[model samples]
Target: MGQVIYKERKNTNSTKWDDCLEKFGKEDLLPLWVADMDFEAPACVKEALQKYLDQGVFGYYKHSDGYEQAFMNWEASHHQYQVEKDWIRFAPGVVPAINWLLHILTNEGDPVLIMPPVYYPFKDALVNNHRTIVECPLIRRDTGYVMDYEGFEKSIVEQGVKLFVLCSPHNPVGRVWKEEELRKVMDICKKHQVYVISDEIHQDLEMSGYHHIPTATVGDYDEILVTLTAATKTFNLAACQNSIVIIPDAKLRERYDEYLTRIRISGGNSFGYIAVQSAYEEGAEWLKELLGIIEGNYRYLRETLEKELPKVWISNLEGTYLMWIDLGAYVRPEDMEKVVRDDCGLAVDYGAWFGSGENETFIRVNLATRRENIELAAERLIKAIK
Candidate 1:
């Protein structure tokens, strides 16, 4: 394994750093917002991109058989789930795929259910497409967040939810849902005949002592489940805009393909195709190293906050680099930004954005930066809250 190094992204048009001032209205703040990492992409991805550039021909391109094989092989090798190539469909990104599903699968005024304090985009996709937003917020326990099984089922039946979007290894409050948990969800949806779309972009970033279960690989969900994932999040290749949608049922695949055709998203870009293939085939070691850094950062932040700010509660990091911390004890909900940004000079995702009225005092911190930045951010937070 090679040593992981961090670089300065301040002037490089990075959304996480360079665009922070404009987005957050705070200049010179340490940005731990957004999900992308400050670390460089895996060597394999960069080398592959360079190779494509060297070809000197950037014409419209089509993915070869090998392109799809890389994804199939990666899933089987890393996740222990085997998927056929024909079941795979290319999406430029995950969020776009969600919007497409909204247009193709459901109609205006139809109800779509999502676990709240989950990914914010799930709600946006539903509302932006003129569908009803059904919220079944996850239950917060001492252990971490879990599904409200009774409430979830009740909402589905009561609201007449046509589609359910699941965030496995759920975001904001990380919890790599166990196999049993996933099975229960699948069984419930199967009973209710509610279609599901699993957003598994964070599947490969699980911590040690935990495993992520692919929603499609669970019990009896072939017809009702569709999965959306991407190497962009896994390997920090988001700028390339590549993601995969796996639909196993033939009729569902036909409908999805027709939507893609209608929207003129016929094929993938050249750079994204090459980058994903290289990442899936040769980036395993890089991923392992990256996860180690993220875990180390999580531990550092958790311990530092516990010792320095006793009343603040930091959620467990089961998966993903995002840290969800409750700052209610130290600052009022309305003053969260003032303390974290204006006072501490730190830019983080305010909890209010995840859900309008809940967890307003919580803030999400990105833990994929160098150790020094994490330490500095912790120090500033301690000072600000005091």
Candidate 2:
């Protein structure tokens, strides 16, 4: 595989670049806010898409047996999780699948639990659908964030929490959860009979020296667990809108299928199917190179920020391309926007957006861009802070 160069995405209808002004209110800011990468999709994915386009038929499509096989093979080979073909189901995106799960699994006003400093959508899925959100914030340690196993179980029992959304290889603060940690969580949720939706969307983007363990692989909690994953985040095919939901329990699968039927979400797009199949089947080498670039970017940002802006502390990035930084010492929560946006001219995901509350001086930066972009952003931040 050859080296993949970063492409210019400013005028390419990219939400991360093209819509920065509309989203962040800054037209000239360097965007490191969105989760999507600036890198192009793998050559195999592009080739498959082009082949489909050349056919010139935009009619309805169906997933072939090869699609399911590709997904199953990828899970087994990459993550060491043996997923059966029958367990696989389709959805346009992980967030949408989450929303659907919210509707089907829990009742209105029932408490749904999430760990904060978590992916914001977990909260939104509950609030938007009128479900009560039970927050069990992860304990922040000097090493990194860890699951509050005691607090987590207590909340589920005390709040009568029916569902839990687990962000494996957690977002913002990147912590690829250990097997012991996941086992404890499974044990707790099992004792409480709480259903878990493990969102492993960032599973494939693990940094060096860390192995991402699938939640279901921890133990036999199939009756109470569902894993949501996608290639879009891994392969930069978010626009293709493809994700996989794996349910091992027959009863749970039936319930979810019934709900999809009720909502009339029977099938996914043709391109999504093709892209997912192509990515899983032929994009491994490209993924390896991408992970190395992301790890390099993370190291660059960490070194640059620590040396120049000593007050700012960057969390250890174990997984995902999002780097969580604490700028509390140098900037106040109330003035973070002005400093980062106006002074630094850098658009980043403010900590508060990820449910950090008033202690909003943390920022999540995207490290999935070119090295030059990373260097430029660091220089601007260091200069601004000084």
Candidate 2: RMSD to truth: 1.0
Q: Model 2, stretches more than 4 Å misplaced?
A: none
Report the C-alpha lDDT of model 2 over 1-386, residue by residue, as the tens digit. 45565889988888988887898887978999889988889888889999999999997787788888998999999999999987898889999999999987899999999999998988989999999989999888876888888898888888999999999989989999999999999999898899999999999999999999999998999999999999999999999899999999999999999999998998789999999999999999899999999999889889889898887877789999999999998988998999999998898999999886633999999999999989988998888888
Q: Which regions of candidate 1 are displaced past 4 Å?
A: 1-3
- Cα lDDT tens digits for candidate 1, 1-386: 36456888998989999887798987788999999998888888889889889989998897778789999999999999899988999899999999998887889999999988988988888878999999989888875888899998899999998999999889989999999889998899999988999999999999999899898887879888899999999888899999999999999999999998888888779899999999899989889999999999999999999998999888889999999999888799889878888988998999998986658999999999999999999999998788
Instruction: Give the best candidate by lDDT.
Output: 2
TM-scores, all candidates, are 0.98, 0.98
TM-score of 1: 0.98
Model 1 has an lDDT value of 0.90
Error of 1 at 372 (Å): 0.7
Local distance difference test, each candidate: 0.90, 0.91
